[model samples]
Target: MSTATDDGTREDAPPTPTKKQRRAAGIAEEASGGIKLILVKLIGLGIVDALALYAAFVLVMHEQWLVTVLVVAVAALVNWIYFSRRKLPAKYLTPGVIFLVVFQVFVLIYTGYIAFTNYGTGHNGTKEQAVSSLMASSLQRVEDSPTYGVTVVERANELGLLVTDPDGEAFVGTNEQPLEPATGVEYDGDLAVSAEGWKSLQFADVLARTDEVTALAVPYSEDPNDGAIRTPDGQSGYLYVSTLEYDETAGTMTDLETGVVYSDTGVGAFTAEDGEQLLPGWQITVGFDNFVRAVTDVRLAGPLVYVTLWTFAFALLSVATTFFLGLFLAIVFNDMRMRGRKIYRVLMILPYAIPSFLAALVWAGMMNESFGFINQVLFGGASIPWLTDPWLAKVSILIVNLWLGFPYMFLVCMGALQSIPEDIQEAATVDGAKPWAIFRLIKLPLLLVTVAPLLIASFAFNFNNFNTIYMLTDGGPRDSNAPIPVGFTDILITMVYKVAFTGQTRDYGLASAYSIIIFLIVAVISIIAFRRTKSLEELN
Candidate 1:
């Protein structure tokens, strides 16, 4: 073990590491960590790319190229940020920003766009689509056309037809493609047993996709006039031709069967010479008409005024009652002498703990006019129209809302009360000031400082409280004078919902206009309330 080196050092002593060696080791460790990070980012980028590809496919199928491009571009940017080393903060923010743009920003912009157009049940999609739909509706089977056995299939969101020609030749096609001979076709009972790309739809599948199957039309060699294969039962295909023929050069749709001609009126629909219009017109922009109708339509304006006032009153009363009840409960429990305060607080919160929708349904059953618990048992069989009568329904809504909303106010007020300083209250007591005086003059102001913003938020929430009004009353106890199902119990939001969905005339444009107004009103009121709260803070 004892040996001498050339430099006269003992062989048992080890050589120390140099500065270059240490530096090289540190560099290698950092490179290893960087490689791991790159791998994780690459995996994440792959998942994002796959999702973006699927989304782009869907949007492109719907002819929304702009949205598809935006999705792809955003996905690319997300990958880029994660791939780059300098943009660490963006890695965390990209997903949330993408979702916000897709779900919130796009929805708001689309809603605003719809408000300026007649996009409702009867008026939807583009002009060419409307024409095709009109023609599809007026189709009749050709008298001499042969009946072909068929099977329904699906491609993307569209339906396809697998039909056997009279010669027992199988052809597979969709509305967009002409019927072509299909190879490798398996046959059973004169119909297609199987096709390579097409799936044979069962009875249940056909039933579920009845609309799509009914809308499907496969052309005979791309000539629509040359009778095509159509299916009503999704099993038997027939050759049919549109009775209504559209002449592009003349810009007129002629009914070949009736000799009636309809010309485009530049108002989104084709109108006949006799003033009759076709069903399912195309969407078209009508500047300010919907907005004007919201404010000036004699039919809607009258009821809207009453509903607006009622909405205000209802919101104000609900907040007032709930806050007072909750505050009283909080104060009672906050007293140090109170016994079992925690248990009582928990019991009080049970109402708020239950889902509001379920609670509304429960209340609705309990308040039934003839056989409900309140009428049958509590009132000794006296029948009362709790929901059918307008005034009584309004009262019932307030009571139910108070029960549901107070616990939230109670919890907030309790937290605020606990946070208030004990020193100020003790000093007031020592100065011989009464409890009510100290509370009203000093403690109340301090409490308001913490609770005022919440109160405003509560007021806004109640103003558009759709579920309570809808589930209990359905905006009913029907008003004969109103345009749509307006009643004393109906608030503005409920009225808007009724206009959009409840009636035979679903006017989405007007409903969107109403929604925009509601949004503006809420936003302005919130801003004003916050400013007032700030003033109160300044005064204090």
Candidate 2:
């Protein structure tokens, strides 16, 4: 290119840039890139720091000191690693390590810990909390108790009662704080309407939080025997005393009316001589009791055994049925003579395109015994009891799962089939082998070589197929005779879910134990299946 010189004469520019000029241009580009990279890094680190700060704040508020420290430390380490020029590998590996620990290692460790404890409803708190809960639940109004004028107050989001005693002394108390003499107390008639640093709730506020106000029990003193003050209407406070007295030194609770002393037997609860135990027990380690209960407890053993067997059958059969059907469809459509192959392939995958959970729900409606599409329309109003009967429910689940699962297998098999070298099949044909012989000896083995791992994965998925079983039958056809609410259709996962969440008394420890067993079972099966697939690898 040419440029006009200062004298207005056309002159040729340098044919190539000088080394110094090129070096200067390269330096400028590198500087701009460095600035952009620094900006991006700072923005990324800022977001990470903000999230870490939030997580640390939450952990500290929950008194999880160790976790809060870990969060802060991790965030600091991340910032240091990214900011440092020397730690290139660390900057790349940090995210994966963090995610693996948070999502995998932590979950496995927590689940294992829960499996060894009685961390369920009524056994979810510390001993002190349990004692307090027990005492609060057993509170009864003192006979001939004089009503004190009360005003509901709040400070720092905590509800308190401003009480005017019979002698006209004003006191303020919250759930955490015992009654103390109030300063700067304002009165509306005899009622202690307000106190310093506390906002007296208006009638509307009291009405809005009626449940909270009514449930609030403010201690009259630090001593449990002294009782607490409670209000029903937020306007009148009554002295409600606990019927049980806790002896801290003895670790015993005495029923005042019955003169019965219940002592802590180290079984997590205050137990009486007659084998009766108090509710709201503290959590305790039970060693292998939960695991033992699953295998040996008379109430759970029979149902669990049946559920385990059924789970195996369901997973195995689901894999078999889906694979064969999908393989057949893929083979038929893969033929060169088949017209509109793309359209057929698309139609075949339509079921796979819908979300599994939604499909399960739709199938659940279709299989409804009375009003379902299957019984009403397909069977011309026949009452099949597809979900209610035990055998029939199993059949219904298998059918629905087959429908939901086959399309995925079909897509996989189609790709594998199409990828097989055409020359091998032609050579088999030229060798005068029958079609069945060629497929049986050549195609099926090769297909299995590619599809074996997928088959194992499919089995694992169907084994934990909670959505299909849950949405379809909800593990119903209830086995009332069993101790817990189990059903004929319940798989191991569904059974664990029911034990943990569905009933009035949730046994999270037992559920976690079941979950551990399930994990072990799946892991073992997968290991064996993968080892077996080594033979298939030889075919490749």
Predicted structure with the largest TM-score when compared to the true one: 2
What stretches of model 2 exceed 4 Å from their correct place? 1-58, 86-89, 144-149, 155-157, 164-173, 176-198
What lDDT tens digits, residue by residue, belong to model 1 across residues 1-540? 467989998777556678999897776555435767678867988998999999999899889988888888888888777767566567678878888987999888887988999878778788777766676677788888888889887656667898888899999888767789886789887778678877788889899989888878787664444546798898888888888877777778888879889898877788997889887888999988899989999888789998999999999999899999999999999999999999999999999999888898899898999888999999999889999998999898998999999999999999989998899999999999999999898878888998999999999999999999888888768898776777888898999888888778788988899989998998999999999899668635
lDDT of model number 1? 0.85
Predicted candidate 2 versus true structure: per-residue lDDT over 366-424, tens digit per residue: 98888999999989999999999999999999999999989999999999999999999
What is the clash tally of candidate 2?
A: 0
Q: Which ten residues in a row have the lowest lDDT in candidate 2?
A: 24-33
Q: Scored by CA lDDT, what does every candidate get? A: 0.85, 0.91
Best-fitting candidate, scored by lDDT: 2
User: What is the model-wide C-alpha lDDT for candidate 2?
Assistant: 0.91
Please count the clashing residue pairs in each candidate, in the order shown.
0, 0
Error of 1 at 457 (Å): 0.8
The TM-score between candidate 2 and the true structure equals: 0.88
